[model samples]
Target: MRLRSLTLACSLTALTLGPVAHAAPHSGHRDATTAASAADKKPRPDDTIIAVVNSIPLTTRDVENRGKLFALSTGLPVSGELMDRLRPQIIRQLIDERLRTQEILSRHINTPPEQIAAAIAGIERRNGMPQNALRDRLAQDGVSLTTLIDQIRVQIGWVQVLRQELGARGRVSAKEIAQREDALKRQDGRTEYNLSEIFVKVEDPRHSEDELSFTNTIIQELRKGAPFPIVAAQFSQSQTALDGGSMGWVQEDELDPAVISMVKQMPVGAGAISNPIKVPGGFVIITVNGKRVIGHQPGHVITIRQAFLPFDAPLNPEHVTPQQQQTLQKAVKIAQTVNSCEAVAAINQQNGEKRPSDPGELQLERMNPQMRSLLEGLPLNKVSRPLVSTDGIDLIMVCSKKEKNFADRSPSEIADQLMNERVEQTARQLDSDLHRKAMIDMRIKLKGV
Candidate 1:
């Protein structure tokens, strides 16, 4: 009996079946680690050329196939817009695969031929099919079984690499665990919200009967055909009214008691607009749009950015006005004006300080509550304003956001995840730093295509 690799076959990806039609014109991958399309490769016609990254090329066929899998896994519709947004993620995955495989080859990390054959045979047995059944499916799907095996091998190799490289970086103090336990018990957990808010400030809930009717009419329109965001933008008196009422995700306990009670009754995929609820300055036509309970899995969420700051590379410290250095309020303004990481780099360059090759990732929760507050409120993809940190002026950019659900630990899984997380950060930082140091040339050579 061919036992299937549950990790590979039962992934959320299996849901997205069928390939997408390849679009013409390939886009180039900008990263140095991008893979080249092997297209002239196997014979296929539905495929079109996409962009190239470095020497590597991505074909339309590859995107369609991978996109279908990614879409199915995420349960999101495969819209062109979403596809474009996912391009960076796909490219990152491709780069990771390429880097991993390249490392495998260099490190002589080869899987035994018997292991491969056995795995395939096991999968065939699980499905109660002949060995040729897989070959036949591959033939029909235009995907190779070998290709899947290679991907799995790369994933295994990456894990091996992490185990070796990040083994030493894993350690948690008793103090940290105690603090985590305390936070779990007393951090006010998060407030949950079952909110369908018109978002106007309320001076009174029962204004003119006309006001109530007008708001109810808007709610009805939303229930029928009008988009909530569109209406919220047109009528919401809140500061973010122009943003179309995208409150993003809200936890349940965060809502008013009445609002929370109403939302608890609403179903996940459906919601209803309640009669205008009384509030301060204005009446809220509570639309129980969606509700989620407040609480997060126990584990610290850290937002880290890393680049090794090189003390020997260069140095140019800012000539701060004595006036600016002494004052807290003045420094806050200076922090807000700093834009991207590139800006910070430029500032470092100007200060003549050698910036580290990889930035450091800071644990967000360790910061002052006020600092944590700012970071939490911002979108994940955005950078934070520099805060007057005890450690000097601290600026932050998020790398990957991970929440460890504290409850499901078998000891091994916890150690593995903790080790893996550190290893991932270490790998990124070390690779970036070492790649720069290993590079032979300082200048780019331009060539005509």
Candidate 2:
């Protein structure tokens, strides 16, 4: 009887190991006994022949193909450990999805097919890819269009379910909105801080038991005085992680509400650490180092400039044919010869038929990196290098620079910013709470991926 029970349990378990699955049984957690008896045989992922979700069979083809898809998309080295971490998160996610799908069906909520198609199209466009390009990208990550479609269906269906399950009739009182508005008005000229932080990225929403436990352990270590920079280097998912995740002191309003609330409650010299901040993939552990005030001065006469490259985008050196290289050279030539910011603007417009005037405000404190570095040690009226901005080759002329004075920030202004921050923090906590509680048969493990 136990043998048959174990076999049946294993079959059901595979469903939870949807894409890349992992399972290790340990004592003292809910479902621990069940996990031990069923998972003791420890079937290798490939050996797990079939997955049954609510008695519905899911073929190995689905899981393997999905795994291949995930691997191709990320382009990261897929070590044994990576696979082990990927499995449980993927499986649980799929299980939740299956459950969500059933609820949607039971509610009889309909997601217009056209709406789903439009949404998918918008996603592709935002990624700057053609329809076929999206498919190619997915294929590169080992994903099939079919897989994407299925995922989208599940998501759209969920939206329908949410609309039906949670009615949107709830309203924020006028007094609440007025209070929030006052909170907003208070932020003007208020001191923003300059600080550095290490943010450990949480990428997987449905974490494997091992991965969850591992991250929790890391978070614990971080809470216990681990150096922010060192810990970030080891675990943060941000590109800035290489530099200890130093994006510099973020504006209070710019931080994740949870992070900001935690910081607000602490003193200046004090650093606050969070229990993993969840993301679509995993968790982010943030440790703040410091903060400063930020603002733009009206006397801060700023000149913003950039060279345009029109539709004549650069050549892909990797696969550039001679003709493509020639076209790119012309664009580069036009960009290199522009002598001054004004000249660049004129030339940018000279090709009236070539590229439109792409201009933006020049905020000294918000200038791009290269310009910020170049102007840092130099005095006023400095002509910066052709800094690469989002538009094109750029240079800046700081008309003036002045110290931020208290006259710019009135008490009401200060109070408003502080209050909005307070409200935002509350809203964020509520959001996290709702998400955490929404899971079914959810297992949270607090030890190694």
Candidate 3:
């Protein structure tokens, strides 16, 4: 998974920043003079410096804004108790971010401005807003756009640093790729999970309790609505953090025993490992994106054509409108008469249905249970009974169905797996080295926070 900017914002803000208080600016433009004036007026005592990472100061205002952002994003109440629990972790995260960014700067790794703009544009597009809409949203939330941009810059720059460390070794040789492919072939028919993870390292066994507490807080935020990817990006110790902690598809044998067990139990889509699973040096929180029975399952792809007959207004079953009844009759007649995909198209054209005749191909396994069952034994080119949904009555015709063995692995796929493993190992070592050598000064009293 390429860590999209939108997911990063969702993960960073939902659980850390609460709902935006101010109204969005209608113009979507930043007023520099107004911002400067507002800043000049902010000399509150709460804005005192909290901590300094190296020489960079982090302020109380920063913590407060992040707390609000988290609250807003996760829909969690920003109570004093919650802030007390979150303050330490937030400070740690910010300090680490500063360290990573400073390291990147020391190495002279420069992230292009265009890349940042593109990332912002992606965020705007994903949120269904116009260009520069993020600025307005941040302003409404009482956050500077620079805060988000700086975070993104750090993340992007860190990736460059890792890539530099990986160097030519990141590339998998043909022989190695072939070996991986062969190994995968041997493991055919085994279950594999498409997983993402956030690994919190415990440098010393004595600190395990603190790490566990921190991990639990992260899980709480995630369950509340924090984006898993952004959280992983910001805090995961593993190299895969560069890619939003995506581990791609891995068989049970390839993972830590605890992780394997967690993967087996986790349901696909949004369901995460409820508790942190302990491994060698740290605890891991995982999200199972999906799973498949390798080699045994077929990649079932289907193309279907649908005709939608929308009611003039929402249908009321108790008191149906004449227009709704007429539309339902027409849908039923089409379902009864339509035998082929072409005939379904003709019916849609005849009725002047505004919807597309071909809605495109859909993965069989990805469809809902009802839709999958309806199409399970459905004959090709045959129209089914009209399926009434909230939107409209749909007449579906299965245009094509193709099944291919999903287990036949490709060379590039195997190569990527190998590369990821190598990168992960290298990343951990580098992070440990950085921590050992860095001058980190914690000014805030974490014990009381």
* lDDT tens per residue, model 2, 224-302: 5444554443244343433454554346767667666766655554556655555434545555554444443332324
lDDT of 3 by residue, 293-336 (tens): 87765779888887767666656688788888888888888777
Best by lDDT: 3
Tell me the whole-model lDDT of each prediction, alpha carbons only: 0.44, 0.44, 0.68
Comparison by lDDT, 1 against 3, better one: 3
Q: Give Cα distance to truth, residue 41, candidate 1, Å.
A: 17
What's the CA RMSD for each of the models? 28.4, 12.8, 9.1
What lDDT score is found at residue 287 in candidate 3? 92
lDDT of 1 by residue, 146-260 (tens): 5556545654565555455555444644555555445434634544443445643322334344345445555555565344543453345432232344333344434566655
For every model shown, what is its TM-score relative to the native structure? Answer: 0.35, 0.47, 0.70
Q: After superposition, how far is residue 343 of candidate 2 from its true place, in Å?
A: 16
Model 3 TM: 0.70
Error of 1 at 305 (Å): 46
